[model samples]
Target: MMITFTRILICFLLMVMFSNLQAQQLFQLSDDYIVKTYSERWELDSVYQQGTFRLMSYKPIYLAPVRWSSKPNDKPTSDNPDFSSTTSFPYNNIEAKFQVSFKTKLVQGIFWGKGDIWLGYTQKAHWQVFNTGLSRVFRELNYEPEIVFKYPVRWKFFGGQFRSVGLSFNHQSNGRDLPNSRSWNRIIFHMGYQNDDWIITLNPWIRLEDEEDENPNIGKYIGNAEINVAYNYHRHQFYSIITHPFNQIKGGSIQLNYVFPLKGHLRGHVQLFEGYGETLIDYNFRQTTLGFGISFADW
Candidate 1:
C-alpha cells in the first residue's frame, strides 16, 4: 500500500511540475509586468489498530503585479515599489514553493478504547527569482526536509479531552546548484490541546549548526516559540499563528489563515504574514517582510 501511495504521489508531482513549466514560459513572454507563483503541499497520517487515516493535499497559484518604485537617489522600494517618477523599471520578484508530508501511527487504549502514535515526514522546495523585470535576474532555490513524531497524552486536564505532543526535526539548505547555501538544523517540541471545534498548539524550538555557504561560525544559535490557534465552523476553518525568534536575532511574526471550500473538491486559502527578521537568505542584515498569498487548501 505504501508503494502504491508513493507511486501516486510521484505522478501527481510530475504533473504539477509539468504544468508549471508550461505556464512559466508563457508568463516570461507576457509584456505586462506580472509575477506568478505556485505551491503544493500534502500530508498523511494513519493509525493501524484504530483503523484511522487522514490525508491532505493542497496546490495554489498566485499572480501579482511586478513593479517597484525607487527614489532618484537610488533607493529601492518594496514589492509594489514606486517607479512612477523615474524612467528606470522597478525590480520584480517572483517565487514559488512545493511541499509534501506523510505520517502513520498505531495505538491501543486501556480504559476506554485505544490511542495511537504517528510519525510523519515533510519536504519543501522553494524557488525565487529577483529583479525579474530589471537587468539583473538572480535565481535561487531552497529545500527543507523535516520529520515529526506525535503521541497522545491521556486526560490529565479534563474528561473526554485529550492532548498531544510532537517532536520535529528539520533541515534547511539551498539547492545544490546555488552558489551560496544557508543551512540549519532545528529540533522542535509541540504540544496541542484539541476538542471538536478548536485546536491550540504551542511549539518551542532550538537550532544547532547554522551555516551560510558551509561556514561553521557564520551562523548563530537561536530559539523560537510559536502559538497556533485554529477554530472550525462546519466546513470552514480559521487559524492564526504568532512566532517569536530570539538569540542573535530578535523579532516576531504574525499570520492569519482562512480556508473556504470552492467548486468540486477544491478549497481555497487566504493567508497573510507580517514581520521583521534579522536575515533573509541573501540579504546580509535584518529586514522586514510583509506579504500575503492566496492558494488552494485541504484543511
Candidate 2:
C-alpha cells in the first residue's frame, strides 16, 4: 500500500508541471501577437514609424527683406544747409536650409522600452543683396550624431499619471569648414510629464568644448537650460520654448512655435525668436526675427 501511494503522488506532480509549462507557452504566444498587432497599428497611424529604418529630408527656401535708417550730424559746412542727415538702406536677403537625417531603433523590449541612434546633417546658405548693388554670401554646415536611452518613471508627483525620463549624449560639429568652426559635446537630461492634453518637458543640458577663439569670452564650460510646454487639442498642437544660458557672453533666446495641419501629411510652422547678447550675428547684442516653415511628419 505504501509503494502504490508513492507512485501516485509522483505521477500527480509530473502532470501539474506539464500543465504549467503549457500555460506559460500559450501566454507567451499571446503576448507576442499583441505586441506585434499594436506595433502595426501604431505605424498605420503615424507614417513616422512606418519603417524599421527611417530617413527624412527637408529643404526650405526663405526670403527676408529689412530696412534700417540712421541719422548722422556732420560738421557744419558752407555747402550744407542742415547739420543733420538721414540715410536709409533697404536690404533683400535669401536663405536656404537643407537637412537630412536617418534614424533606427535598434532594440525594443517587452516592457515598452526602446533604444535609438540618429545621425543628421544640415547646410545653410545665405545671401545678402543690398539695394546699393553690393552682395555677400555665407554658408554654414553642421553634423550631429546622438544616442538615447529612456525608461518609464512609474512615479507620480501630483497625480496618478504616466511620465518618463531620458538621457542622451550628442556630438555636433562644423567640420572646421567654416570660419570659427568648432565642435561641442553635449549631455542632455530630459523629463516629460503627460496628463491628458498637456505635456511638459524640462531639459537641462551641459556643453563642453575646448577653448577656441570662436567662443572667446565664454568659458570652456557652459550650461544651458530649456523649458518646453505643449498643449494638444484633438489634432492640433501648440508649443513654446524658453532657453537660458549661464554665462553672460552666451546670451539667451526665446521662441514660440505654432503648428497647423493641412491636407495630406503637410504641416505649417510659424516661429518667432527674440534673442539677447551674442545670439544674433547682425545685432550681436539684441535681435528679433519671425520665420515660417513647412513640415512633413506623421500627423
Candidate 3:
C-alpha cells in the first residue's frame, strides 16, 4: 500500500512541477471565513493585500457534517472490556458507525508587513447519535491546534508565479492522559503557487519527538508531507490532499473534495478519502470512506 501510494505521489509532484502555468490569482481578503479560504490561495494573504484583519473573518466559521468510516479503530484504553466502565465514565466504546465532525480556526491575522501569524483549532468526534441500542455513546474526540506564519512571495517557478511561503507549529491529541493519551507536534514549512485556474500548496514537515512517544511512528504511517491542489471552474471547485513517505509506502492518505454551488451562500460538498490519518485516533488505522455535507467554502 505504501509503495503504491508513494509512486502516485511522485507522479503527482512531477506533473505539478512541470505543468505549464500563467498567472497567480486569489480571491481578495474579506470579512467572511468561507470567502477567506477561497479568496486567498495561501494562509499568508498579505501578499495580495497587506492590511488589518477584519471582524467575523478572523478564521473559518465552521464546517460540520457526519462521516462514516469503513474501517474502525479501537482506543488504546478501550476495545478491551476488562476495565469496563472506568472512573472517568461509562463502558468502553465499540467503534461507532457514524460521527459528528467539524473543524474551525480560532483566530488569524497579520500583525505587521509581509508577516502574519494565525491561531487555529479543530475537533472531530465519533458519535452514535442515531443508535439507540448502545444508548448513543460518544466514541472518540480528537483535538488539534496550530499556529502559523505566512510570508507573501513574488517569484516565478515552473513557469508559474510563486505566491506565498511560511512555517507552522501544529499539535494534535485526544486530550487524555496515560493509557488513553495520544499526541504529537510538528514544525511544517509551506509554499504556495498558482497556475491558470489552479492553486497549489506544498508542505513538508518534521515531527517534533514527544517525550512520551504516544502513537509512536505516526509519521511513518502518515508521511512527512501534505500537498493540496485546487482547481476552479465557474461555480465549482475540485481539490485533493495527499501525503506519503518516500522511504516506505505501506501507509498514506489521499482525500478528494468537490464543492458545487447549490444556491446562494450554500454549496454542496462531497468528500472521498482512502488510506489513513483522517483523525488523530485513526492516525495509524486504515480506511476508505465517503462523506457528504454542505461546506461554507471550497476547501
Candidate 4:
C-alpha cells in the first residue's frame, strides 16, 4: 500500500511539473494570481504600511465537517517514559477538524529597513461531534504562536525567483497537563520561491530542548525539516506538504490539499494526510486521514 501511494504521489508531481511549463508561458504574475500566495503572504512587494491593527492570514483556515481517520489514538504514548499515557479515551474515528491562523505586523522596517517582524498565531482542533456516546467531546487541540522576521529577496534559482527568507521562533503545545500534554519549541528558518503559478517554501527547524521535556523524541516523529509546494491552475489549487523528506527513516508525513472554486471567494476543499504527527496528542501515532470541507483562506 505504501508503495502504491508513493507511485501515485510521484505521478501527481510529474503532472504538476508538466502543467507548470504550460502555465508559465500562458500566465504571468502581473496578470494577478488569485491568491497572490507568496508576494502578499510575505508582504514582499510592500515594505511598510501605516496601520495600528491590521491582521493578515498566515495559513489556511478551513473547517472540515467530515474527517475520517484510519486510526484514532485512543491511548496516546510517548518515547519519554514520564510522558506516556496509561488512560484510554473513547475517541471516534470520524470527527470535525478545523484550523484558524492569522498574523499581524509588529515592527515595520527593522534592521535598517531591510526586514519586518510579525507575530502569528494558529490553533487547530479535532472535535468528535458525531460521537454523541462520548458527549461530543473535543479529541485534540494544538496551539502555535510564533514570531518571524522576514527579508525580501530577489535571487533567481533554476528559473524560479527566490522571493523571501525568514527566521522564526515557534512554540507549539496542546496546553494539556500530565500524560496527555505535548509541547515543543523551535527556531525555524524559512525560504520561499515562486515560478509563475507555483510557490515553494522550505523550512528547517532546530528543536529547543526543555529541562522538563514532555516529548523528547518529538524531533524523530515531527521531523526537523518540511517543504510546501503549491500550484494554481485557474480557480483550482493544489498544495502538498512533506516533512522529513530527506530522512524518511525517522518517520515523515505527507499532506495534500485540493481547493476548487465554489462560490465567489469560497472554495471546496479536499485534504489527504498520511504518516505521523496529525495532531500533538497523536504526534508519534501513524495514521491516514481524509477530509472534505470548505476553505475560507489560503496559506
lDDT of 2 at 107: 36
Cα shift from native, residue 163, model 3 (Å): 0.9
Model 3, residue pairs in steric clash = 2-249, 2-250, 3-249, 27-39
- Total clashing pairs in model 2: 0
lDDT of 3 at 257: 81
Among these predictions, the greatest lDDT belongs to 4
Question: How badly does each model clash, as a count of residue pairs?
Answer: 6, 0, 4, 0
lDDT string, candidate 1, 1-299, tens digits: 32344345445545544644464442232211111111001111223232323322221233212211121112222221221123333433333333444333323242234333333434443333344454443333344444555555645454324466667775655433222434556788867665556666788887665323342322231227778777767656677776665564545666566765555434456555555321223222223333333333322
Highest TM-score: give the candidate number: 4
**lDDT digits (tens) for residues 125-230 of candidate 3:** 6665555665876656665556667777778878778777888887767665556556778999988887767778899999997555767667778888998888
Estimate the lDDT of model 3: 0.59
Candidate 1 has a TM-score of 0.55
TM-score of each: 0.55, 0.56, 0.71, 0.86
lDDT of 2 by residue, 237-290 (tens): 566776766655555667566666655435556656566421212212345556
After superposing candidate 2 on the true structure, give the runs of residues whose Cα lies further than 4 Å from its correct spot.
1-102, 110-138, 160-162, 176-178, 209-213, 216-223, 246-250, 276-285
**Model 4 error, position 77 (Å):** 0.2
Computed on alpha carbons, the lDDT of every model, listed in order, comes to 0.42, 0.42, 0.59, 0.79
